[model samples]
Target chain A: MIKTFLQHELKAFWRARNTGKNVAVKIIMGVFILYLLLCALSAGFFLDKILEHAFPGQNIVIAFCGIILIYFIFDLISRMQLQELPTLKVQPYLQLPVKRNALAGYLAATSIISTFNIIPFILFVPFIIKVIAVGSGAGVAWAFVGSVFGITIFNNYLALYIKRKANLNGWIFLIATGILVLICLGDFLWHIYSIKDISYLFFGHLISLPALVLLPFLLAVGMFYLNFLYLKDNLYLEELNSKKASHKSSTEYPFLNRFGTTGDLAANEIKLILRNKRPNSAIKMSVLFLFYGLIFYNKPAMMHTDYPVVFVGMFMTGIFIINYGQFMFSWQAAHFDGLLVNKIKFNDFLKAKYLLFTLVSTLAFILTIPYVYFGWRVLIIHFVMYLWNLGVNTTIILYFANRNSRRIDLSKGAAFNWEGVGGTQWLISLPLFITPILVYLPFSLLHYRDLGLAVLGAAGLVMILIRSTLINKLEADFYKRKYTIAEGFRNK
Target chain B: MITISNLKKIYNNVLVVNVPQLEIAKGESVGLVGNNGAGKTTLFRMILDLIRPESGEVISNGEAVAGHENWKNYTASYLDEGFLIDYLTPEEYFYFIGGLHQQTQAHVDDFLSTLTDFFNGEILKKGKYIRDLSKGNQSKVGIASCLLQKPELLMLDEPFANIDPSTQIRLKNMLKSINKQHGVTTLISSHDLSHITDVCDRILLMEKGRIIKDIATNSSTLAELEDYFAVGQSVISSLQIDEEENH
Candidate 1:
């Protein structure tokens, strides 16, 4: 039965009823794998740089390990594709004499079948290839191979776990933050015991290879178990297919009667995000800004003052906000018809989105509070960023996002060559990421920290100030192309 | 249940839809029949307030629907699976719509009990996400949702397009019963004349953005209505024969 199911999945992929772009993405990833392979082969020339420490060859293993770890991060980050897991749209097949276990097993196994991990095999294996062949048994080589497979499956499950957790509650993030806190504070606690660098003991040591071997295996098992549990829990029709975004309109919401009924609409949008996938992603995206400061936190001088590079870095990520905002209209694309038929006010509709933006960016602004402690100047810059994002990027993205044609499968993970991102998005990103650099670079060239900071600040402020006009421009632009955008999104 | 007046929706300087005064009274079942781009959907949407009329507005319950706050509380529609929020199972979706108007799940379950034959049994127990369901099954879920809501106004466009024939008949009967039982006003659009004829009281045949014929299907036989649409009248046909013989 398992074999039959596996064969079916393989056939299904070949004849998958997915878009051309999805197939094309698989091909594109193949190219990426090739490039990664070539990079590894080129790096093989420096194999002798290996044993600088007692664990001289450890760095290569670490490099290989890093590859595994980072891919896991990317997998989790790109939660859209793998997060909810591909719902078995073909579950009707369950009644067609197919064993339930077979169907479930097929899904569980297919989770590990991706081409993303091919690069590590090409890079890491060759480093140990000669060493294993000459001395250790092929069992060692087999372990390396086994470990790699384990990594792939483990990461797949980790991503799935995070996604499932995220779908359920906010505690996943709280837990993740808690974990990060523990990692950072571990050294401080270890120092109190005058202990060794913790990371070096388990991960860096060779004997710990068994744990590494078990890591991926355990994760894969855990994930399969999760998949099984999810299926078991949601096997009923009502539980499986219901849109879960429903919540009682809390009468106590102070803002409810302000916009009157539209206030409820605004309140629903908040619930839509909180109860839906986007808000979690939006929160994750917001927290990502805090991680940026962490990346620079380790730098001594960089923390003391606002560095142009970091400022550009901070402002460069302004595109993410735009990216988030791009789907402003499309998210509601499904209900566009309802919005029309019900005679709902378009102004209220637009106002609900704007209100939604205010709510999100405010959350993001609060999330970025940590930057203030980085420096007083960072505060001014991010504040300008907040306004600029509200004023400029919000309009810019809504305008172009109003133009983006692809239908975003909100249920799918938004990572790793996912669809709905288009050429228009690229154009939007260019100005958001680069334009800030142009403003910052000129000031940096003149050797003025405050001036460069001012340039960034002023640009954001100007965008905020002209927001109304810009929004008007976007509205006009949207009105012009609304039909085409609407039509394209529903299909894609 | 619904009315549209002087509705003109211009797109790129073109008069895409120009619907002039339409009144659908309480519990009336109306079918909007239009050829491709005859402005049937645009008219429905304008009435629904999904799109603004460049010139006019739609009124519901003697009030402009466009300005009302709780129009949706009593208005349940499924334009397509998009409105279905495919993540939810059929039962979940029904309960959600049911819940929205302050109905309980047991109420919805009781309402759904009448439509057991239509469900074809067992998929409802599968907890299948609406996205995972087949198009026909999805339509069943959608139709069941609108009916379960017991909305005073239900607008369903192309509801029968992708459904299987058996389910189509079930849906036709379901819509009929719902309209009769609740006095729910329904505006359904479909290219399938037969399905419309089976359910609708009045069929508004639209061509080139105007209602060219308002056939009282309840009063007239399907054959006569078909002939009226074909424009193959006795005189027009005889003239065509003479012209053909001359050619």
Candidate 2:
């Protein structure tokens, strides 16, 4: 039965409309995984040496045990974001003569075959062999490895269960992430608890008593059974229906009504972004990236430099447009036909896009204003970049939007989604990052850095004033290619 | 209401829609009938300017449809589920379409109140996005939005294919009333011959991307269409029997 399922999955993949693109993505992802495994392997090999160097006088075994809990906490959080739930395509088989328990067992078993489950071994096995085997004897070392493996399995099933629960209630996912963040901050920043002490207390004791390792194995088995039971109970087609008549009230912004049709259009787009998964992830990513200034700012080397400041400023202020605008019109690929045939003017539609970009970039700029503590220069650069994004990047992204015709399945998760992305996106992003630097480089080289910033602002101002003309040209370009774009979207 | 001249669309070197010249008059209700791959929807797409033709143009009310915005002001069409923003609830979709036509929210509410019977109490206040509705209910929503536009030129493709029997009758009446009372020009395509004859004044039969028969709707129109399709079906079934005997 499992073999049949595998064959069906393979055929389905190969017969998909975008098989070539899917294959390319898989190969790229394979190489990336290989690179990550190599990093973990090397980290494993020298972990004992690194631990000894960091804690010169402390016992190396205790120190290693202290880091174990910290590692698992971070592991669980990363897993929540990156781990994909193993799909049980049981709908078709429900009418067949297959046993229900067999399907549930298959799903629970396949969920273990993840890189997240393998990375811990690659990261810890070498240290166990090199240091623990030499000192703690073979039986104790083996027991240590066993306990760690057991805990790894436990974390795997726990994370999967939480993610499955998150699917039914979105707040569960948010609350899980929030609790993890709070735990990290509590131990590291607030100093309210000593996770390291607790880790040493538990793992250190495990090293001394090999027989106690069964506790972890039992815990692992308990979690696996929990998952199996959950799957068995909820495997019914009716129970599995995720679209259970969503009772969410329709959200409207009455203030937006003042802007007339353009506002209404923009408000509609806002709902599209908020209510869908992929676009919602884009917004979440933009919000998360706003914290990137913390990593770049206040560094003595970066503070004195002009180019780094400009680059960081550009990234911070324009991240939303950069992230979301690359797939502008394609976001509405499902309804592109309706949009074209409706009573909407291309100019007004384009105006709505501009309105959305300006509003979002302005909000992003305001969020970056607290970086003023870093220096006045930082604020000035961010404001200038914000202006450049509004006038320049918005137009460039919209221009490239005409070239992207691939339909995006808006409900799909955005972790590694490559939908609607093509060579045009990569080519267009280069200019967005480089244009600001190019404008600033010559002025900085000529020892007139202040004048360079003024020039950037002036260019943006000019573009802003002539935006209507730019929109007109874009509308003409859209008219010429609208058929091709619509055809590409329709094929899906 | 619409004129097609030398219009052709080819996919993979196969001409899917090749109408050289066709005219639809104002205030006329026309029904297009064809089997699968008969280019009914493709022709409707060309008329809406959703897909460009390989040659010539579609003229709506004396203006070319391509690169023109004037026709959209008075044209409303629903060819498939692609015509819907599936994320929006039915009411939100109706209001959005209504808002685009400069109708106030209260006006949209009044129009929706009139559709309560046609909707059959399954669409309004259902708390489901258009994507979640059953196929038949989704068709009802799409047709309702088209009517809400009060368009001069309304086009629908396979509108009756997914709708229920009672709703089909209701829709037939609605189309007829809209055409007679409002002088709206409507072009509807369907595989159901009886319903098409009941709703349309004129019938067009298409085959292999070409219009082979154009007839005024009369008592004999439904029987003629059925006779033509029955002959094709008999040929297919006999070919299968011959192959089975050979095997």
Candidate 3:
């Protein structure tokens, strides 16, 4: 039965309309995975020597044990973000004569084949062979390998269960991430307890006492059974169909009523982002990028750098404009004909898009105000970049948006679904990032970086003043290509 | 008033829609009848300026619809599910459309009160997004939204296709009352001969991208359409019988 189910999945993949593109993406992903495996293998092969150099006079095995916990912590976080739950496609199979246990087992077993589960083995197995097997007996080394595999499987099922729960209730996800962050803070900042010591105590002793391998093996089996029971109990179609009932509350943005039709349109766009899966993720990702400054601003080496701060400022302030605007018309591809035939003018439609971009970018700029901790100079650069984003990047995004004709499926998750992406998205990034750099390069080279910042700010201000002229041009460009866009959207 | 002169559309070297000349007068209810792939939808899209014709244009109220925006102010169309913003609740969608036509919330509420029978008590206040509604309910929402605009010219494609038998009758009566009361220029395309003939005074029968018959609906209009379709059906059945006999 499982083999038949797998065969049907294979056929579905082969028979999809975009098989050519799907295969190309798979090949690209395959190459990327292989490269990551190669890097991990090399790092594993040199782990002993590197540990010796980093922590001289300490036991290399103890140092290796110390870092293992950190690796798993990071692995858990990455898996939470990137893993996809395999649920939607199982609906049809539920009606068949196949047993629910068999289907649930297939789902749980298939998840273990992910790259996240294999990457650790590629990185750690070599160390077990070269360091542990050579130093300890072969029996202890094999037991150690068994324990690592057991723990990897345990983490896989645990993460999958948490992710599934998170899908049902968002608070689960928040609580899980919050717990992980607090644990890290306690270990790193407060000096309350050491994860390294705990990790060394657990894995370091497993070599001497091979019987301790039962601990992780028992954990893996326990989690597997829990997941199997959960899936078996919840395999009914009603359970899946009822998920949308929890999302029924409607919101009214009363303040948006003031802009009349334009405000109404912008409010509708906000609903599109919040109510759909793909756009919701895009908004969440833009919010996540708000903290991106912490990576560069806190680094002592990057404190005095002008170019890095400028780049970060532009990204932090204008991220939503770039992310959301690239698919402006395509976001409404489902209803492009309705929009074209309605009483709304093309100019007002474009103006609504401008208002949405400005509103979000301004909100993002205000959110980034905490960067003043670095200096007032950082705040000034961010403000200038914010202006540049509002005046310049918004237009660039909308201009390139008119060229994108591919329709995006709003219901699909944003992780790897490349439905609406095309050459135009790639081409738009050049002007979005590089134009400001070009304007600032000459002044920075001549030791007048402040002058360059002021010039960029002034240019952005000038564009804002003449935005109506630019909007008129964009509206004309949109009209010229509206039919082609409609035709392309209708093809799907 | 609407006029189509020398309108043409070709897809991959095949002519999809070609109307040399056509005209609709003010306050006239027009029903376009055609089989699958007969270009009813393509023509409707062109009239709405959603698709640009290869040559000539659609003129509405003496203004060319192509490369112009004035015609849209008085025009409303619902050709398919694409016309709906499925993420919104029905009331929100209606209010949004009403706001586009400068109608306030109270105005929309007043308009919706008239559609209670047409809605069949399943659409409004259901706490469901348009995407979650059944096909018949979705059609009701779409048709109701088009009417809320109080458009001078209204277009609907197969409004009775997904609706229930009861709602279909109710819709036919509602459309009749709207036409008589508001004198709104209306265009609809359908495969149901009796329904179209009963609601629309003028009927256009199209075959292979051309209007084969144009007749004013009277006592004999439905029978004439039934005979035409009966002949086409017999030809198809005969072809299938020949294939089966050969096998």
Candidate 4:
């Protein structure tokens, strides 16, 4: 049964519509995992030397024991972010003669087959064999290894169980983050408790009494059983699919309704961003990236440089344009046909896009007004970039948007998702990021930096003035390509 | 109001839709009937300018649909669930469509109140996004949005396939009344022969990417379609046997 299930998964990956791109992603991921394995292997091999240098006369084994609990704490947090919950299409099997318990057990067992469960073994087994087995005998070394493996299993299932619960009630995630923060504060800042001491107490005993390894082994078994039970009870289609009825009332920007159809279309676009998961998370990430200026501004090395400041300003103000506008047409892939056939004119549609971009970039510019404390120079650059983004970058993004036809599934998470991305996305970023620098580079190379700023601002103003012509061009281009775009979207 | 000349669409060198000449008069109610892979939807897409033809053009109201924006003002179509914005509530979607056509919210509500029976009390104010609705309900939302446009040319592909029996009957009546009273030109494609013949004055039977028969609907149209499909099934079964013996 397990073999057949694995075969199905392999076939699914191979037979995916984007198999070529998925293969490329898999290869890149493979190289990344290999790099991490190397880092952990080297760290494992040289631990004794590093600890010896840090702790002078103390035994490195005791130092390693003292930090094991802290390692697991951070490990649990990272696992929660990275590990995917094991899911099977249980609906099909439910109607067959298969047992529900067997299916649940398969799901529970597959959760163990992840990189998080293996990394700990590679990092710790070498140290245990090299240091503990030779010094404290082989039986005690076996007990230490067993405890580490058991704890890893415990963390794996615990993270999955909590994430599953978090999907049901979002506060579970907030509460989990809160408890982790408090633990860090208690040990590192408040000094109310020491995780190191607790780790030393427990692992220190495991060396003398090898039989105590059963404690974590039993905990591991208990977590596995708990996951099995959860899966068995919640194996129905509704629970597994998680199509929660959205509680958000449909938003209406009445102020936008006054702008006529363009305003109504822009209002609908806003709802598209807020209501869909992929776009919602994507906008949230862009909003969070507004703080990107803290890295470059006020730095003595970067204080005098104007080009990097321009780059930073462009990014902070126009990140939403580049991120969301890159797939503008594909965002409506589901209803592209309806849109094409509706009463809305193509020119008005383009105007709605421009309206949306201008509104968002203006808001971003106002938020960056505080950067004036960095100097008036930083504020001026941001204003120029805001105009450039609204006029120049938006047009460029929409020009390429006509060529994009890959359908994006809006229900998926934005992080690490590569859906609807194609060669056009990679190529479109070149002109958006580099054109401003190229426009500013020549004047800055000579000592006429202020002239370069004026030139960039003037270019934006010109694009804004001739915006009607640009829309006419875009509308013509869209007319030529709408058929191809609609056909590609329809294939999915 | 639609005229097609030398229209052709090919997928991997296989002609999917190839019509030398076809015309839909201003107030004609036409039913397109074909088996799966007969290119019913593909032909509708070309007329709506959703797909570009390889060889020719679709002219709507004396203007080519390929590059003209005027056809969209008068033509409304729903081909599949892809025609729906699945994230919006049905009412929100209706209002958005209504807003595009310059219909006020009150006018839209009045229009919807008349559709209470067609919606079967499941569509309005249900607080469910279109994606969460059943397939049958989603099609109802799509069809309702089309009627709201008050378009001169209305096109729907298999609108009755996923709808309930009672709603299907109601929709047939609605299509009939709209054509009779408002003189709206409607082109519906469905596999249901009885329903198609009942609703449409003319029927176009398609086979292998070409229209093989164009029959004016009469009392004998349903039996004619049934007999054609019945013979087609037997021919297909015999072909399968021949291939099996060859293998």
Tell me each candidate's i-RMS in Å. Answer: 8.7, 4.2, 4.1, 3.9
| TM-scores (chain A) of the candidates | 0.72, 0.80, 0.83, 0.73
Per-residue alpha-carbon lDDT of model 4 for A385-474, expressed as tens digits?
888998799999999888777687664433223343332344447789999999999999998999999999989989999999999999
Candidate 1 lDDT over B1-247, as tens digits, reads: 6777887987566677777888889998988876566677677666655555678878888788654646776887876666665554566556555655567668988988888898888347664656567787887787777777678988888899877788888889878987888788989999787889889988888765788788778645467667765663343432211110111
How many clashing pairs in candidate 2?
0
lDDT tens readout by residue for model 2, A1-492? 888877887787797656786687677767877989999999889998889998999988899999988999999998887777775456678779988888888888888988888998999889889888998889988888898889899999998888777655556777788798888878887899989998888888877888888988999999999999987887773443644545856778887888787888898899999888667767776787787787678577877767777888888888889989988898898888888899998888999999999988899999999999988998998888888888899999999898777787664443223343332344347878888888889999999999999998887878988999999999999988998888767765
TM-score of each: 0.62, 0.85, 0.86, 0.81
Better of 1 and 3 by DockQ: 3
Candidate 1 C-alpha RMSD relative to the actual structure: 10.5
lDDT of 2 at B141: 89
Q: What is the lDDT of residue B113 in candidate 2?
A: 97
> Cα miss at A369, model 1 (Å)?
3.8
Model 3 TM-score on a 0 to 1 scale: 0.86
Q: Which of candidates 2 and 3 is the stronger one according to DockQ? A: 3
Off by over 4 Å in 2: A57-59, A87-90, A236-252, A274-327, A367-382, A388-400, A403-466, A473-481, B10-15, B52-57, B106-117, B120-129, B237-247
Which residue runs of candidate 4 sit more than 4 Å off their true CA positions?
A52-59, A169-171, A185-192, A237-251, A273-331, A345-488, B164-166, B238-247
DockQ list for all candidates? 0.13, 0.48, 0.49, 0.49
Candidate 2, DockQ to 2 decimals? 0.48
How big is the positional error of residue B192 in model 3, measured in Å on the Cα after superposition?
A: 2.5
- What ordering of candidates by lDDT runs from best to worst? 2, 4, 3, 1
* Residue-level lDDT tens digits of model 4 in B62-138: 99988788988888888888888888889889989999889998989999999999999998877887877889999
